[model samples]
Structures are given as structure tokens and as C-alpha cells.
Target: MDRLSQEKPLKILVVTQYFWPENMRINNMVEGFVAKGHEVTVLTGQPNYPEGKIYADYRRDPAQFSNYHGAQIVRVPIFARGQRSLTLALNYLSFFASASTIGSYKLRGQSFDSIFVFGVSPIMVAIPGIVLGRLKKAPAFIWILDLWPESLRAVGVIKSPRLLGWAGKVVSWIYNRADYLLLQSRSFDESVKQYCTRAISEDRLVYFPSWAEDDFSGAAPVASDLLQRDDSVFTVLFAGNIGDAQDFPAIMEAVKAVKADLPVRWVIVGDGRASQWLARHVAEHRLDNVLLLGRHPLEKMPALFAVADALLVSLKTNEVFEKTIPGKVQAYLASSKPIIAMIDGEAAKVVANSGAGMVCGSGDALGLANIVRSMGALPATERERMGLLGRRYYFEHFSKAILFDRLEVLFRKATLRRSDK
Candidate 1:
């Protein structure tokens, strides 16, 4: 029989807090599995993410079931409507509580080959994975998009170290239970290995960077649009979330320091909690060179990046950001734009090794300004070569084709092992 007509198509159950119609890394895993001849089912909550508002189209159905493309989809209720505080915590908790109840009651009886889950809102989502995997004899695969309490604590969002330590134990429990754990970055993989030593193995903890679905034709023609028409100036583009992790204040300050002298313009695209603060800061500081555009759909990123003289990928000066890889780096590489990464971690290490871009200490406005000046000073051809290097680096190490191929092989191995046992 053909691969698709084998003894049985692998049945995969994915538990996540976010999904399609929402721009998230988890979507890639869902789509990757579905395309690889697996019978995939995604168990997730109604769409509400960076915006912190539920999508209007999906009305709550207590026992909802639908199909996305060829895969099954189940969306549970999550209270993220009006405010964001403990309410948001409750919202995430609700999905865990509800999905655990509904999945254990309704899905426990269904046999699946494997369970794959995104680890965020951390341990709560793991209940179904642990319960269903135990009952149905399925192997559990966990994808860590962010390390839990460590991430929260790094951002100063969760202050109590003692509480964070408790959260870490919960993370440890879920990690120990997973059959396989995939991290978004190599640095993250190392960190998880340190904390949850028993849960992950050297081979099982894979490093598959995220990717964008783009056909690279060539470098986008130099952005001559009104937003970037100044032939006399170099424009540094910072596009993506302007939230806690991204220190936009430093970016604005860097722009303010050199805008007049170096003929540089700072263009910030995308919006988030700190966007209002950034706008107000710009107004208050009379920082005219900094321009803010509201968040655009994902499709627009390549074009925006194409026009950028250089792309800025920055994170707040924190230890966590070092271990974290920004998704925008892939898009910038796809656009054949050189990166000006203001992050000092594995991401910087990767860029430096690729010879794609430059990195600096996070929050160093003078250093950022200096790096901006250095890139601007490069000969036009030299700059273009650097951008090309970035694209080549992306294709060699982080393309979707490569990542999905690796994933398919892993799934096959996992399923075959389960069958043998």
C-alpha cells in the first residue's frame, strides 16, 4: 500500500491556545503535520491573542467540531473579551479547564497515534495531553514557544521569585511527561535541557527555527515609496510588536540622537501595549524622525522589509530575549534585507555566523546609532551583498521545506515506535 494507504494514517491531536487566522508559530506545526499524510486535529481556544480580543466570527459552541482544510479543528471558549488582567489569566485557565474536561470526556475514548501541544499559558494546556495520552496510549510531543515562569519573570511581568519557582516545578512536571519536546531556538533548547533535564533528550530536543511562506524572487526594488523616498537618508525599519519585550524607547532615543546629523529615519511598524506610550514619547520628545504605522497584515511584511535599508530586530535588555529568536528575522531574511539586530543572545550569534547582519547590546542607543551609521557607510554593493547573505543563510538552515521534512521523519519514527511497542 502507498504511504497514505498504510495500515492506518497517524492520528494527531494538537492542543494550543492559538491557531490560524491568527499569526502564530503554532500554525506552522499544524499545517506541517497535516501536509505530511497525518490525520490532524487541532484543539484550541477561540482566536484572541496579541490584540487580547476574541475574534467576532467564531460563536462559542460547547461541543464545537469543524474541519480546517483536511484537518479537524475544535475551538473552546476563552474569556478574553473586555479587559486584560487576572481576567486574561482566567481566560487561559478556562481553556485548560474546559478543554481538559471536554477532551477527557469526549476525546479520551478516541485512539490517536500521538498528541502534540504548544507550551504556553504553560502547564494548564498539558492536562489534556497528559490525560488523553495516558488513556488513549498516544505519545505526547510538546513544542515550547516560550519557557514559562522564566519568560514571565524575565519581563518583570511576574515579580515573585517564589511564585515563579512554583511555576517552574509545574513546567518540570509537564516537561517530564512529554515524549518529545521541540524548542523554537537552540538557546532555548539548551535552557530547557538545563531546567527540565529529565524531560528532554539531546536528540529529541530539536532546533527548528520558524519560517515564512514566501517565494524569494529577488531583492525587492529599493523602497522608493513616500515612506522611504529620501535619497539623502538611510531608513532603519523596526517592524513587529511594540510590546514589553521590545524596547522602543531606546530606539526612539537613538533616532533622536542621530536623525539630524546622520540623515537616518526610524520607521516602526506594528502596534501593541507600548505603542501608545511610544507615540506619546515621540510627541513629547519632538522626535520627528520616528514614524509609527499601525499593525499591518502578515502579507505586507515582505514589501515593508524590501524597502528597508536595514531591518531592526530588538528586544528589551533582558536575559530571556537572548535565548529567544524573533520571528521577524526569517521574514527580513526572506526579503533579502540586512539585519540590525539589537539583541545579545543566540540570535545574534546566528546572524554573526551567517555574515548576514550586525548585533549590539540591547538598549544601547549609542551603539545602535553607531551600527546604523556603519551600515549606512557601507558601499551600496557591499550592503546588497550582506542582504543576499541573509537570504542564503535562511534557505540553508531555516526553510519550511527543511523544517517540515525533519518533522515528518520524526513523526514517522514516533508512530512506528509506538506500533512496535
Candidate 2:
């Protein structure tokens, strides 16, 4: 018998809070899973992500999104986030409730070989993962994308100790029940142990880092008004959500200090809860070099990266954040652009080890300004070398092909194989 035919293709149900049209890592992972000979189905919510409103195309026709890269997509009803606290809170709650009940009813007749949870923020996703797994008699594996309670505290979403204690219990509940937890960062190991009330086996936690989307690697530079060819000034681009964890206030302080003295342009793509504050500060300070281009489609980012001189990634100063590696770090390395990071710990370590570019202490305005000055002063050849080193790092360590294979192994390793179909 052929090796490929020795084992059957595992039927996987991927439960996530975000999916295609949302520009998340899960979308790429699902596509890679389909290509690797797995029968995959995605369980997700409406496609309102960074902007918090359903995409116009998705709104117009739901049928168009039913299948992606040979994997079927099943959507549950959830209110759009609308980019507000009240709505975002509702958005989180609605998905949890709907996905657990309605999602189960929808898939009642079907059986899956494995249940994989694309665990991002809001650990409530794990509850449904466990629920559906029990109903289907299949083992559920959660890919830890964000640490809750700590993430909530880091963003000032919830500050009370007692409430945070309650949240901790919620996290402990999910960690205790999951068959295995996939870790996106090695540093997350300690955090998982602290949260779980039960003693989890060492084998339960697996290192599964984010991978670069294949869409970006082949896209050529597209001429647009957003990315103008200019050599007189160094352009630094920052893409992704403009949320609280990004520490934009500190970046603004740094920009104010350096804009007068350095020939550097700061271009930020995408917006979030912090958009208004960023706009106000931009206008108030008259930081002419800084440009805030609001959110754009994912397809446009490759072109934006292509014309940029360097990429800047920032995270706030917090112990939880220090342990976290923002997904953008992988994309920046893949862009082959020298990186300027205002972060510490894991993300900073990656940038430094990759020889990407300069690093500044988190929330250090003075340090950020100095790093910008140093990067602006570098010779073109030196910058090119840095870009190449970062690209090499991405290909060697963060390629999708390598990660998809690891995912496949875990799927097969799951021993509680459900007999139902």
C-alpha cells in the first residue's frame, strides 16, 4: 500500500472567533490544512474583525463564504463589534453562546476525526471547543493565541482584583478540561501551568508559532498613493490593529522628539479602539512626518510592505505582554524589511536574534526616538543586509509548510478518535 493511503485523512472541525475576510492567522492555517490532505471544516462567526463590521461582500452573500480552500465554513450568528466597548463585549458573548448551542445543533448529524480550536483572545472559545468535542466524542485541542485575565488587565479592560480572580477561575476551567493546549510562544508554558488547577502533563503543551501567509510572499509591489517612491526620507511602516496594547502614546512622544531632527516618515495602516486618540494627538502635535492611514484590505499590505524602508512593531509595557509575541512580528520578518520594535522579552528577542533592526524598551519615548535616529542614519547596504537576515529567519523558523506538518502530527496523535460519521 502507498504511504499516503496507509492512514485515512483526518476530518477536522476548526472552531475560531475569526476566519477568512478577517486577516487572521487561522485563515492561513486552515488553507494549509486543506492542502496537506486533511478534510477540514471551520466553525466561526460573522467576518467583522479589525473594523468590527461585517465585510460588505460577506453581508451581501453568505453563500460565497461557505467554502474556503476546500474546507467548509459554518457561521454562527453574532452581533458586529462596531468598534465600541459595549458592542465588542456583546460580540464576544454572542459568539460563545451561539457557537455552543446553535453550532452544536447545526453539526448534530456530522462527526469529526478531531476538533481543533483556533484559540485567540477571549478564552471563552475553549468552552465551545470542549462542548462540541464531548458531543461529537472527539478529542479537542486548543491553540493558545492569547492569555486572558492577564490580557484583559494589560489592556485595562478589567482592573479589579476580585473580578480578575473570577476570570482566572474561568481560564482554569478551560485549561483543566482540554485534551491538549497548543502554545504559540514558548514563554506561554509557565502561564498555562499557573492557570490550570489540574496538573497538566508536560506533553500536553506544544509549541506552535504563527506562520507567514503564502499570499504575502509572492505579491509584487503595487503602485498606490499610499506608498510613494521617495529616497530623500526614510519611511517606517506599522500595520495591524491600532489598539491599546500597541502603546501608541509612547510612540507619539517618540515621534515628536525625533520628527524635527530626522528625515523619517511614520506611516501606520489599520485602526482600532485607539484611532480617535491617535488622530487627536497627530493633529495636536502637528507631527507632519506621521501619517495615519486607516484600515485597508489584507491584499494591500504586501504592496505597502514592499515600498517601506523599515517596519515598526510595538507592544505596551506589561509582564503579560512581555511574554506574548504579537503575530505581526512574523509578518514583519517575512516582509524582508528591517524591523524597529518597541517591545521587550519574546518579541524583542526574536527581532534581535534575527538581526532584523533596532529595538527600544517598551513605552520608552526617548529610547524609541534614539532608535529611529540610528536606523535613519544607517547606510542603504547595511539596511539591505538586515532585511535579508530577517527574511532568512522567517523562512528558516516561521514558514507555514513546517507548522502545517506539526499540526497534522497532533491531529493524528489525538487518540480519542470518534467512530461516528
Candidate 3:
């Protein structure tokens, strides 16, 4: 049979707390599904993400239900994520509550072939997917982006052993119930298997890494004014969340160590809880070479990438992070920019394997500084060659087309399993 005949189009409902207007990889996945002739509906919260506050327009009720790129989006009521940890926890719980209650009501009569949960943070988000999947007699597929409890511990969120044990039980419950688990890193398989029961077959666990969104594929000419950099200076750009996990202090130290000798500039292009502290630290240290560009819209990322010579990615030294691959690595590879990965595990391995960039141990400021100086010393053509190789690797392994093909097959398998039961 032909591919389409063998794998029929599916009605896929994506459950995610974050979506469009909030620049997440899930947006790309939903769009890809729609492009493949599948009916896609998104159950998500109002647009309030990296920034704690919701957008002004979305604060109104009319913004709750809308269609984007041919996918139906149903927004539930969520407590706005304030800057405080207590508020953030409330924000997560509120979404879990609303998504389970309101989502069940909204999707009561709807039938879907599979419930795909974009599991990034707070595994609690999977509750609705699990509930709805059971209700509809469909398979629940969870794409594990961040492993919970361990992730919480890594970020110093939940330190108590009792709380960790409770969280682990909750995680194991979700894993046991999930019909399929898609992991972003190969190393995640063992961690997931540890929690899964015999009822959850090992074959259901799959290694499925993220891909750069369609936008990052091509080069866009950036206006010089937007970058605020002279053509003479080499720029090493780091984009995405500036949270505790990123260990930006180490990056700052690396910049400080090399500033006198290399004359390269460091461009940080995102916002988070740590943004204010990073800016203040730069000012306090008189680090003129470091420029905090603040948060820009997702559309501007291509332009920003155009202006950058090298891309930087970092994570704190943690066992949890060692098995994790930061999503931005795919984007950096797609941008065809040589990477400097100061992350000690899977992310670093990816960069090294792709021959796209150099890697240093996480939080190793001196080692990162030396790598920076070495990258600066390399010939422009050599650096460009590295970037080209990275781009080739991205297309070969992490392209959207490759991901979509794999997901199509997985969806077919999930639906087939449901029917077999």
C-alpha cells in the first residue's frame, strides 16, 4: 500500500499549556500536522510564558478561542504567571485544574485518534491528556521535553525527599498510564523505563528529539540597526531563556576572561527571571563587551541569527541536564551557525558529533573562555565550514520533515493499538 493508504489521516488533539503567541516548538508540530491533512485542535492556556504577564489583547475573553494556521485553539482560564514562585506554582496548578475541568467539557463529544501532550515542564500538564484519552478511548501520547521531579530538583524547586517521592509517584502514574512516550533525548529512555510499569511496554518508549521550526531554515537579511553591532566585531549570540538552568554567570565569566584578548562581543537575546540580575551584573562589572538585547518577538530571531557569527548554549552542571538537549541547539544548527555548547551531556555530544562546534564542561568558565578564544582565532572560512556541516546534520537528522514522518508513523501505531484493544 502507498504511505497515505497505510497510514490514514488522524484527528489529533494537542494538549499543551504553551502555544502560539508564545514561541514554542509545539506550534511547529501542530502546524506540521495540519499541513499533513490531519485535523488538529489545541487545548492551551492564554498567552503568558517566559514573561509572567499575558499580552494586552489576549487579556480579553474574545482571544480565548481562535484559529491559527488552520488549527483550532481552545484557551482555558489560567492564573497569570506572576514573577513569584508561589504565583508560578499557582499558574501551573490553575492550568491543570482548568484544562482537566474545562477541557473535558469542551471536548466532551469530540473524538480524536490520539491525545498528544506537549510535555515541557510541570508534568501536571499531562492530566488533561490522560483524562481525555481515557474518555475518548484513544491513546495518550506524551512528548517528554523536561523530565519532572528531577527537573524540579535540578532547578532547586523541590528539594525535600518526601516531596520528591510524592512527585515521583505522580510521574510514575502518568508514565504507567501513557500509551506512548516520546522523549527528546536518547538518554531519557532509561529514566522513563525506571518509572514505567510492566503494563507499559518498552516499545512504547521512543526517542524523538525536537526540530527547529520552519522559520529557522532560511537566511533572512537583518537590518543593521536591529542588531546594534558594527560589522567589524565578531558576535557570539545566545538566545532563549536566561533562567537558573542556563548558568549565565559562567558565560559572563567566560566573556570577561576573553574580552581583553579576543575583542569579541556576547549578545544575549531573551528574557526570564534572571534577566534583571544578568543586566545588573554586566553593569556592575563594567562588561562593555556583553550586550543584553532583551526579549524580541520570534519573527525577529531569523534576522538576529543572520547577524551572529557563532551561537552559544549553556546549562548548569546537573545530572538532569546531562541527559537533556536544549531545544535551541536544533535552531542553532538550522541557522547554520557554529555552536559553543557549555553543556556537559547530550547537547554537547550532539554538537561534537555533528562537527558543528566545540564543547566544554558545564560551568567551566576558563574552559569556555579558551574555547571562545579558539573560535575567535579560527579562520572565517573554517568557521563557516563548521556551520555548514552543522546545517547538513540538522537536515539529515533534526529537520521538520524527518520529525513529521516519524510522528506520522507513531500516530498510526498508537491508533492501531487502540483499535487492537
Candidate 4:
């Protein structure tokens, strides 16, 4: 029976605006499903991410389906990726419009067993998921990557109570219709269950954490020729997006507070709208401890992770952020580095449970600075032990192999139930 199952591949249709070569989890899900003996079909927009512009190779042909690695992709239309607030919304809406119109035709009447929708753009991609599932009679699984209306509300992007309620209804509708709901964090799972009135069974909701890439395996110890090494200086690196939600200003304030008492350096890597503003603020205040490196290539991240004595993970002080565990935390654990998290809620709980890192109160610059100073004071042996703990926790929990095994079960469970029905 096992051999027979292996011979017949499970067909999975994944709908998301982000996919491979984009370096996000939505891409990982498709590739992971394919690796587990599933034939995967992707409905996504042309690659336009942090830059907010269509990828150079894809601009001329926005509506094309190409094979990437083992997975098949159906690229839909989207407004170019950008920071222009309005363009981002329109870009999401465009993908929804295009995917809803073209997905069935693109699939050519292929009968997929399951449809997995990546829930980042909320209603934007939900339309395709709902429409395709109805057309194909496939069971739809919605991966709640982030909570929708609540996240938007926390960011102050959507303020009207009536508008929030309306958005909530739309989101709840999608959740209620989904056959399964996957959330990344425990806090997220709880919130998602409350937000959806659909009375989904506990079995239908699964907690699947994001993972470190296979390329991260056996990576060499962090070294940087570009970065000057100072034995007297302790470096704390914040690598990844320096966006509004990251609480970059708090990180800056913390670094500034410590500069007078200790020789600690804060390296802020990655680019975003907040990054430029951070640089300007650093210049205006003459902050010596803060170094803004902008964005670096993904290949160079390991070395950045290596050189730092400790990794800094932070988020704004808001209800939405409490449910999030930043993706970088996995990378930090993968690198076996000690972490100092300025995030409240779920991530802090993880840090405590793993014994891999320390967490201070949210947006507490003074607390952050004091912690940095204390961590710097620790002996090298003590720090190494903390890092080892983090790596061990990651290996046991967030490793790709472990994650994929759980997914295999999910796939079999999802398909077996459909077959039985």
C-alpha cells in the first residue's frame, strides 16, 4: 500500500502572492510539499518584494506559468511590489482579481486533492482559494501566516471600528470556509480560533513553526572580512527587515544608553522605510554605537549571524506583535547564537522555554541596554553554553527534517480523509 501510494502523487494547489526566490515561508511550503512526494501547483504573482518592483526577468511576461525546481508555478498579475502604501494594497488586490479569473484555466481541469492558501494578503489571496476549491471540489487549508484585521489595527493602518468589524467579517468568512487552519505560533492559533466563528475542530487547527533552510546546515562559523573585529567590543546584530514593526527606534535608544558605560556595538542590517529614518535619527543624535548596514544579500547572512556575540530580535509594543515569532529567531537558533529578544508574548515564551535566549519587556530600551551590558559581561564559556542550548532547541523543534515529517503526516491525513469520504 505504501509503494502504491508513492507511485500516485498527491496533487496540491498552493495560492500565495509570494513564492520561491523570494526567501519567505510561503515558498518553503510549496517546496516542502513537493519534496514529500506531492506534485505541487502554485498560484502567485510575479516576483516583486521588498523592492516593490517586478523581477527583471518576469516584467515582460507577467502572466506565465513556469517550472521552478520541482514545483509548477502560475504567475498572476500584481501591482509592482513597493513601499508606497497604496501600491501594496493594489498589488494584493490585483493578484486576487487575476488568480480568481485565471486559476481554473491554468490548471487545465486537473483534480487536486487539496488547496493550501497562504494568508498574508488576507482577502486578496483568499478569493482564489475559495474560488478554486469550489471549482475543483478540493479541500481548502488556510495557513494563517499572520492575523489579519487585528494586525492591521495594531499598526494603526486601519482605525475605524466599523471598518475593522467589516474586515473581520471577511476574514472570518474565509476561515469558516477552510477545511483546515495552520498557524505558526500558539498565540496565533488561539486568536485565529476566536476570530473564526466556524467551530473548527481542534484537529483541524495545527501548529507548524517556520524553519531554517537546508543550506544552513553545517555552515561555517561566522566570519566577516568586511567587519572589523574588536576583542574589547561586544557586538549585537539585528539582521532582517528594519521596518516600523521591528521597533528599530527602541533598539537605537537602547544602544545609545549603553554607549557611555560600555563598549558595545549595535549592527542594524537590512533595508526598509524605517531603515532610512533610523539612519537620519542616528546622524541627528550623533549615535556612535549604532551602525546601519542597510540590506545584505541572503548568502551573507550567515557570516553576519556568526560575528555577532548575540542576535537581537525586536517588535513594536502592540497586541498584534505579541502573537508573532520573528522568522530571524529560527536563523539565530540555527546558527547556535545567543539571542536577546525585545519582543513580548509568544516569542519571549519560546525564548524562555528553549533556554536559548533572554527577553526583556517590550520597547524597554533601558532594560534592553542593561541586558546587553550583562550579556557582554558573561564569560565566553557561559555564552557558548547558551548558544548550544539554542541550537539544540532548534534541532529538536524547528529543523526542516522534523517539520517535514509532521507535514507528511498532515498530507497523508488530509488525503486519506478525502479518499475515505
Q: What are the root-mean-square deviations of the candidates from the true structure over C-alphas?
A: 3.2, 2.5, 1.7, 2.3
- As a whole number from 0 to 100, the lDDT of residue 156 in candidate 1 is 77
Q: What does candidate 3's lDDT look like per residue over 1-421, in tens digits?
A: 2433474579999999998888888988888889988999999998888678987767675545478789999889898898898999999999989999998898878899889999978999999999888898889999999887899899998899999999999999898889899999998988888888556666788889999877788655455456865567779999999999999999988988898887898899998878889999999999998889888877788778878889999999999999999989999999888999899889998999999999999999999999988888889899999999999999998988988888888888777766767
Tell me the whole-model lDDT of each prediction, alpha carbons only: 0.76, 0.87, 0.88, 0.81
Q: What local lDDT does model 1 show for residue 122? A: 56
**Which candidate do you rate higher for lDDT, 3 or 4?**
3
Clashes found in each candidate (C-alpha, N, C closer than 3 A): 0, 0, 0, 2
lDDT of 4 by residue, 1-421 (tens): 4633444678889888787657676676677777777899888877887678877767665434377658888877668858787888788778888888876678766888788888774555787888898888888887776788888788778999999999988888888888888887878877787777968889989898788765444658457754666677898988888788988778888878898999888888888768778988999999877888877767677777778899999988988898888888888888888999998998898788888878898999999998898899999888889999998999998888887677656766777777788
Error of 4 at 25 (Å): 2.5
Per-candidate TM-score against the hidden true structure: 0.90, 0.94, 0.96, 0.94
> Whole-model lDDT, candidate 3?
0.88
Across 315-359, the per-residue lDDT of candidate 2 in tens digits comes to: 998998898888888888887889999999999999999998999
Task: Quickly count the clashes in candidate 1.
Answer: 0
Q: Give per-residue CA lDDT, model 1, range 1-421, as digits (tens).
A: 1342354557888888777767776776677667776788888777776667776555464333366657788777677734667887787788888778775675645778778877765556877777677777788877777877778888777798889888888777777777888888887865687667474557777776677655333445444343645667787888888898898878877787777679877788899879889999989988777778778766666666666789999988877788888877777776777889888887788779878888888889888888998999998788889888988888888888888767666666777777778
Which candidate has the top score in TM-score? 3
Regions of model 3 farther than 4 Å from truth: 1-7, 61-65, 228-231
Model 2: per-residue Cα lDDT at residue 318: 90
